[model samples]
Target: MLRRSRCRWVFVCILLTVLLRLAPLKSDSDPTTQLIGDVDNTQSFGVNPISLILVQKLGYQSACNSCSHRDLGFTGRVAGKWYSVWADTLWAAPGVTDPELDTPGFHGMVRSSVSLLTDDPLRVVDLNLNDDWPVPHQQPFIPFNEDWGESSRTAFGGASLCEVDAGSATAAVFILVNAFEPDLVGAGVAKVQVINGTPTVTQRFGPKGYWWDATTTPHYGDKISYRDERSDYIYIWGGPPNRYTGWLEGGYIYLVRVKAADVFDLCKYEYWWGHQQGWKPEVLTTFTTETAALWGTGQGQIVWNDYYDCYILVHLGIAGVTLYMRTAKSLEGPWTPDLEIYSTTPIDGGLVYAGVAHPYLDPSGKSLVVSFTNNNRIEVVKVWFK
Candidate 1:
């Protein structure tokens, strides 16, 4: 009887241990209860010190009489040997005064490159598609077919570019935020590839009545992407419909991912359905009963911080006056609550928005080159997180 009792106790303890290991981790603060079950399930707590300094407002001194632009949102990416940025809502006229804000001939987007030299990293120059670098000129490169229905009649508000592989490869996946187009009412994807000796762009519009199935509605505005070395997959994070889109729904965000090689294949997409369901082949549609959010909603970018040994998210407030930061152990995370990092008064007649962190600009990850739109121009700052 004594031996039997001991054996029974041992069996019960073993069962309990297995159950605890299988249960999902929960957080009181994170509404989604982010389930980090993979190998990189590490968490960091407490406050991390961060500092922000005004680097310089990026200026464009253009001689191209056909280079007028809009309230620009700067989303930078490392394409080939250069840092390329998607400059949204461009016009071919000499200049666009405030009266021309609603002008009709606004081409959707253009590509610009920032000089990657250590001397001046914020210099915006024209992109040389042949060599895949920035030249000493200010004329932006129009790499897409503006006459196409997908590229025409649309103005982008935000963009995130994920290079398929690190290095001189010119192939990448671009996610863009469509601003107030009656037909293209949300986000879209563009596959950028260098064919033969020139660059070529192929794009697909996002959830809309005419373009794609409107059931799977995911707002790519303020969206960001990161390549996980462990999983060898690039994760795209996006959320809460832009209130400007006339979307009065709840503010929630989700994540989707695809292998680097399969980025251009929409059929290979996988949606994050939390710990129980894990990743599903089907997307998170509008009517899905269960929804998950990636640390709430805001316009920002996520970068891995060597100092914090975690992922850091630097984003702007809804009003765009204050900038905030959040830290998480993993990409799919129980992220820390918003910690106000910087706040400043907006310039006269200018609102601050479209803030994102450029990691390639600061290779050491000690300081970040952050950019945002202020006074209808893109301004940059240096952010330090110790």
Candidate 2:
């Protein structure tokens, strides 16, 4: 009896331990909880750290000016290029497709990329939404290489797109990325690969892993970070891995810095010298849920309006985001918040997403020429603000 009792106690203890280990890790943040989900989840406007204007001039030309109204949204730095994600009216979503914001799956969730402008027609890789990385209108040199897939549940195919700043030579492409991959089922371990000749480098995470279906939180905006100060690294947030990934509806922001030294300066005769250069990225902090907004039932478009003067987050998910502004002078707390003037509801369209032109100043600076996706057409938002 005594031996049996001891054995039973040990068994119970072990079972309890396993249960505790498997217990779900809840996210403390609201937005983080919703945005950075298992499968998950832009640009621009205004200023740089140096305090110069972000958008200096604005221009528009419909790449599909002649096509049968195809959907395209892919922006690259090679000078005026974009590719939409949609194939046609059949590809429109409940939000953009059903514009009245009358879609049944009313949750404000954008699981893919939306291009603002395409230098040419829209191109799409024939891959699953949650399983492939698309190389916008352009074709990959290596036909065997798959674009890219959503690694962790937090990311929604790890959407990525490029944007040409309004006034600066500095261009960027926000991508759904993971610096590290966790060992779990369903969560895919990601590997970032740059095009063979795009003057860029790629990084690979740990062995491929899968996501845990149990985590269904919403994942939002990719985290763009600068590790070396030359260029920035972009990370797509999602759920998985007991450690690095946060289990909640949240936003993951990673910083990848690109420096002049890291680039291959053929003009100046600089090269990698046969060295492998990968994206060096790190996580900032995760935004909580209550603080962030959502797009469901009634509202949509929870976006961050970042500028050089400050990072203005518009919580359109709730009503409008609490504008938080930070400047190069200081990036700490107690920044200015635009308690007013940030519109909550869309006037003409439903949820609005900025396209390839991440809000730069126009030559006029009196207005903001922003390209956004509505239902069918890639429309531009002309902000007549100072």
Candidate 3:
């Protein structure tokens, strides 16, 4: 069953990519920003209606020549320093998938880690499994565990992070856990601790007996609250239902909120069931419907922009391969139509996906810092809103 699902998903992705190439290009009237300069011989291509600028290019090359990392899981400020979590692997090249390397028990299995960002030359610090960092062969902050499943190993490539107070004496890091095997994908929430500037997973919240699978429940954390000012609760953007057919599909983004004091109480979370009629609290329901579609693959960033008095959402179109932005006055939003920010074209023989926004990195409230994953590198760009 797992093999079949994987095969079907690959076929669907290929067919969708081809269909997108054949579709007519979307027209945009919004004013955009152009690339300021080039990096690593790669220039930004396509129109960015959101005025995104290429500020700096962060390369992942480590002192150890073989391993590399991609997939920006999440970034947050911990103990007065900026840190990012990413999915890392030991593979030497792209497009080379060895089952031995892909399996859960593989020594070089994909794992998650937190890295400190430094300024002098724009490089990563304290990178796990890298010679440049002090920590070597340190256990993954969120490693594949026995409780997940016999064959299930987890890689949180698209995870989101937020700082929340669990009413504890120490600060806590809330992560949207994305777990998957070759056949299935699931999500949940995990509590992480910063021990001496390193992230250590301490607890998890989700369904009983099984990992947070989409086929079993409608509630799974996608993006956690980045800038909700409320001290009482933390908000999470939920993803689509995980289908057995291997394609997780949904057009509307959902909202889930849990009390900041009760971050670990999975049963206490409230879903936004409100509609056009009015707002109401429900146990587990979607925040939006099909009529108000927010297109994406459920991996993106959401930040509150005080300058605009609204929430900004950045995501990648699964079919179009374009990065887009939408704004809403409220968390349960009547979101504006997607304004094309940037689109991915074939670069260095690889495709791009998962364009996310880093509002904390943007010094000017009007400028936005965006990051996207290419086949070989993670590209970061800056955008200014008109």
Candidate 4:
């Protein structure tokens, strides 16, 4: 039954991608079709007009034909500039997928611009902006934690700035990284101290080199965070192996949170145990079959929108090819059903993932500048929710 169900989903996704590819690719207007049903009445997220504008690649075309790069995480402005951390980068000739070509990870900053939400094209310049910076390739943001028992492993496969301590003297930033070690593929947190505007690794917090919760079973945190004023806590999201696929990539996400001020301490971390059951002292991993998820999958981000007065979650859906959006009044419960927001086949001939929303780019929340990856190329879209 599981095999049959999976096959059916694969068929549906392929068919959807094929149909979407036929849509128009021109910018500054709606696509040939609005994949989310009619734009008139109920299906269009109510009567609001949604426009996807300036669908262009985020940076210059790679010098190599088939460079593969994906998974972008944004950092707080350090020394007057914003940074984007990427995972598994490669610069190679066309059709090159050799494992040896992997550069592991790297970071870059957006070129000097007054605003990221502008309609003009944007560029994600390499860290070469600073000549004295030790990292020429912007690699090795977090060294492999030997304490995690993965000493033989090299750099972290993925990294994201999950929390920023702006009030501190040196603006401490907490980064969540995926070890990606064969035997210990899980998540860990490291502290990055910004001194004189440059980010430097300080220390690592938590024992989650391979997070087991209390069960000690490995899980993957997409390393996405959102602060809730009602609880005054920043919720960190992780996903266990999918019930269907048995892969930790993205399915049935769970939450654990710590006070923004206490992110360095593991004792303060609390897990969600449903609305009625509330939160508990110990790390909560076990969940009843009846437990509900805020939304499905990872490889995305959650941003609070002031215009809609709700939190908008943009993620690469379970199908793996499509990008989806879901909205909720609060971070905890009662999220709307998956709404197909963008189709990659129409833009990049498919094979796209890591759909993230940049709320910092649009302070008004009326329009969102979203970034996603297609092989080595990173593309941004300006989505206006009218």
Each model's lDDT: 0.51, 0.28, 0.51, 0.49
Residue 130 Cα positional deviation in candidate 4, in Å, after optimal superposition: 11
**62-163: candidate 2 lDDT, tens digit per residue:** 432121122223233323332233222222232232233333342222233333332222222222222112211221211111334442223322222333
For model 2, the superposed segments whose C-alpha errors exceed 4 Å read 1-76, 79-335, 339-365, 371-379
Task: State residue 315's C-alpha deviation in candidate 4, in Å.
Answer: 1.0
**All candidates in order of TM-score, best leading:** 3, 4, 1, 2
Candidate 1, residue 314: CA error in Å? 1.5
True lDDT of residue 29, candidate 4: 36
Per-residue CA lDDT of model 4 for 281-340, tens digit only, reads 776544332232443455666777888777777777653766777777656655666766
Worst 10 residues of 1 by lDDT: 129-138
- Using TM-score as the yardstick, the better of models 2 and 4 is 4
Residue-level lDDT of model 1, residues 40-127, one tens digit each, is 2123245654544433434422312123343433343444443434455343333342323436664334443222222244454333
lDDT tens digits by residue: candidate 3, 187-261: 566776666556667776555222355654443455434536534656666554543122223444456667655
After the best TM-score superposition of candidate 2, give how far the Cα of residue 212 lies from its true spot, in angstroms.
14
**Residue-level lDDT for 78 in candidate 4:** 34
TM-score of 2: 0.38
Supply candidate 4's per-residue lDDT for 384: 69
